[model samples]
Target: MSEIRFDLVTGKMVIIAVERAKRPHDFAIAHQEKKGSKDCPFCPRNENMTPPSLVEIKDGQGKWLVRGFTNKFAALNTEVKEIDVPSLYRGEYGYGVAEVIVESPYHDVTFGNLTLEQMKRVFHAIIERYRSIVKDEKIKYVQVFKNFGPRGGASLEHGHWQVIAIPFIPELVNREVEGTQEYIKKERKCPYCEIIEYEREAGVRLIGENEKFVAIAPYASQYPYESWIIPKEHQEKFEEIDEDSLSKFVEILKPLIEKYEKEFEMPPYNIVLHTLPPRDIRNYHWHIEIAPRLTIAAGFELGTGVHINPVSPELAASILKLQNL
Candidate 1:
């Protein structure tokens, strides 16, 4: 059966077509693992391979558990002075920040295998880096994202996350801010908060929840088996999360990743943390989106701005909930 679902934040539509799952190559069988580790820049003993660390989390012996550094090949550089341009047509100097956070000292260890303590360190390191980057008034938004496996857009196989600071708000984030404001104006309530309550009450799309966080398969998922983890209380920025909430966030996230590992054999996936701009905190809710690269978007999706999800959020949530950690 096929059904259409609309994204509340972006107003984009997606078609849920279960029958399409029968098509060949609809889902991936296994997550590709990196073969060579000796020459990996992120591996231990390769400190000289990358730029000096901005911040490093260490053990008692001072060995790094997590490290953040400037990307060697930065897409944007703070060193570049801002260019002066006219209003009619504008272009700026590549003035921004690019950083890479190595999640583990070991080459092969990933988020799926990280212990609670290690995960905490990683999260804290991310918060530290983000806070540091946003201190510069020129940096408006900091995007924290992870790419795992080849299909997930990782040229190197080491487990790492990237934080890129841009001078302006992204288009998608702007859409979300505008859409949330519109929804609040019409409904007199936060749309995401309402969604949390509705999904919790419905239970069909709800995966699970902890004291502070909830995991759910969103109604209009853009990708197969796509899932989201959000705080129960409305929050506009990830940096505002307290220690307790951070712990609870990781508690829920762990099992969600385990479910993906078990069901899809540790498939390639991306974790994107969506937050309001550091200065702009109104009419938005922060969330973590896990999009598995199980299927590729072809011409139809690119041409029409529509997605074809082969699995329904209800069924996907049920499957994820049933899996044992």
Candidate 2:
């Protein structure tokens, strides 16, 4: 049997086709234990390999725990102040900031492998750069994202995350903003906050929770094992995360990734942070979305701008909860 679901944020349709999962699993990943890449620029003692640090965090021994540097192959740079579009056509110079956060000192340790303390340090480095980048008045939105393994779009094996600050709001984020605004107008409340409250009570789609955060498989999940960690309150900005909340955020995230490791066998996945832009958006709640690339986007999904998810989010949540972290 099949069912159709609509995502509130993206307004995209998804086909929940259970028959698609009738086949055997295809996500058996034989992960090789990686030793240090001697020439890897992100490794320790490779300071000379990359551009000087934009910012960094140091441990008690004064060794850099996490580092932030401008991307050598930056998609956008601050060099171009502005560009005027031709009257006949619409375009502008790539005028923005592209930076990378080297998540850890160890070349092989990923977010899942790092000590909880190191994960917090990585986030602090990310936040430092994100706060600095967003301060630019010309920048409209800043995106913080990570790519892990092959299918997730990682070119380098070393653990790292990237932040790209752009001149205008991107389409995906804009759609989300529109969705939140419409939900508020119609129901006089925040959609995400409502979702958190609903899921907390329902418990079927929930994976884990703590005092400040709850991890859940969104009701209209677009991918397999898709999970989201969100604040219990109505915090709209990731930059506003205090030390206590940051620790709580890390607490919930660690186990979800561990669950992925146990269930998917280290499958490639994307982690994206969706937060309010520099401009204000009322009633919007910032959260992190983990989209595992266990399935591909075929013709119907690509052409029609819809997704066909084989696993029901409810079943996925149940299976994920069975795996102990």
Candidate 3:
């Protein structure tokens, strides 16, 4: 078989074709152990153990359906008022916002279990938090993510997501923005939008699609079974997503999560939301990446940036599509 290669062009949508594919049985799934009897602070009954709510969604009767609070073991604490740094390598500072979003009162309710209405509320709450945090002049970026199961970095058995607003742009984000800008300047079009249009037309790596969004296993997926959810419209900032589009986003997203859970047997995964910097909207495009924890990072993967995945995305998409998920 010939080796697969990807060549990203300036104005054209590129879809690399893979010549070889692996069967599902060839891949191994990691099973996680359930949490033991240690008291989980995220449990609804133990909500008092956590920091006071920053924001919450209330039921018609005024009961909390979902809640957001400052993380107890935060990477950045607000109380540390003054940070003194004399050297570049060594620095002391508390300059970010870390908050936990408790998804549901029920411990078993994962993202897949969320109803469409509940998921819409969750997205709304996330936008509200992002808008609030960006108003602070110190914050440069806000990252929203969820770690599901132990493999994906979930410490607690209870399902929850986290949002971190940082004072500086992360190196990864900087590189992505620069790459995007370079591509846009040369092509006069968004790289992501080009990919979306190409994926829809190729119809090979497509996992799912709806009126306003399309989920696809990227041609250059870094991990096996990796997928991305992109909005049909070119929206730079997630917080700026209008109500109509937000509803459409939820409509497509909920089923994708359910498909992963049922067909992939609830594989552990990480979900990341990438958007534009609060003040800038020139090059960035908002999207969600769902990376399933299907493989461990070995020395080669760490030493070199390239990843080796045994399962080709076209085959994975075909398998996922056939499953009655």
Candidate 4:
């Protein structure tokens, strides 16, 4: 069976082709220990290999469990204090803040395998670092993301999250923000909040929920096993999320990632945190989007901007929820 689904925020269309599930192993990666081998710079005792730490989590003996520092080969250089390019060319200096948060001291640990306390510490470091960067009025948007495995565009094998603060909001983020505002203007409520309610009532696409967050496979999911973790209450900014809320969010997230790894045989994936842009909290809601790189995009998808998802979000959620993780 096949059907069309539209993303609530962007209204982008996707074709869910259920027949593709027959080739489940097509998305699996071969076992590769080299991806998490030793001698990595992000590992413990190699702190000097990268830049100095902006934030670090330590124990009673002062050994670090997690650390955050400026990215060595940053995409946007922090040297430029402000935009300096000529207006005639319609360009600006690559003025931004790029940072890396090493999530675990161990070389082999992934998000699915990390202890609960360790995960909480990593998030605390992220929240604290986020607070520090947004204070700088020059930065307009902060992008938080994680790239896992070779197919996920990770240069290093280490488990880490990258945080980049830019001078301008990205096109996709802008569209989503606008969409949310439009929805609010007409419906008098947050679109995501409405989605949470809708998914719960539908039940088939709702994987799990706790006191603070809900995990759902979006109606128009663009990738196989894609999941979105959204807060139950309306929260506009990631930095404003308290420790209790973050703790509950992680509780649901850890098991969800574990389920993905077990079901897909360690598939490559990316995690992106989308939140309200700096100083604009009312019009948008914060959420975490996880996209597994199970399929490649070709001409039709690129040309039309319509994704062909082989599995429906409902079926994906059913499989994940049935797992004993």
> What TM-score do all the candidates reach, one by one?
0.86, 0.86, 0.84, 0.86
For model 3, how does the per-residue alpha-carbon lDDT over 1-325 read when each residue is reduced to its tens digit? 1111222332221112222475555423212334642467887668778999988898898877788889876656454355443443233354678898888777777898898888877877777788888899888888899998888877777878899887667667777788899999999998999999998899899887877888889898888888888998888888888888888787777777887788778888999998888897567888999888889888998778578898899987776552221
The model with the greatest TM-score is 1
Residue-level lDDT for 21 in candidate 1: 40
- Number of clashing pairs, model 1? 0
Residue 108's lDDT in candidate 3? 79
Single out the weakest 10-residue window by summed lDDT for candidate 4. 27-36
lDDT for each residue of candidate 2 in 1-325, tens digit (9 for 90 to 100): 3233345556454433334444344323323323458978888898888899999898889888899998876666566544553465434566778788998888877678777888898889888888888788889989999989877877678999999888777778888888999999999889999999999899899887888998889999999889999999889899999999999888888878877876788889999999988866555789999999999998998789789888888988887773332
* 241: Cα error in model 1, Å: 1.1
Worst 10 residues of 2 by lDDT: 26-35
lDDT of 3 at 241: 88
**Model 3 segments more than 4 A misplaced:** 1-38, 79-92, 322-325
Q: Clashing residue pairs, candidate 1?
A: none
**Model 4 quality (TM-score):** 0.86
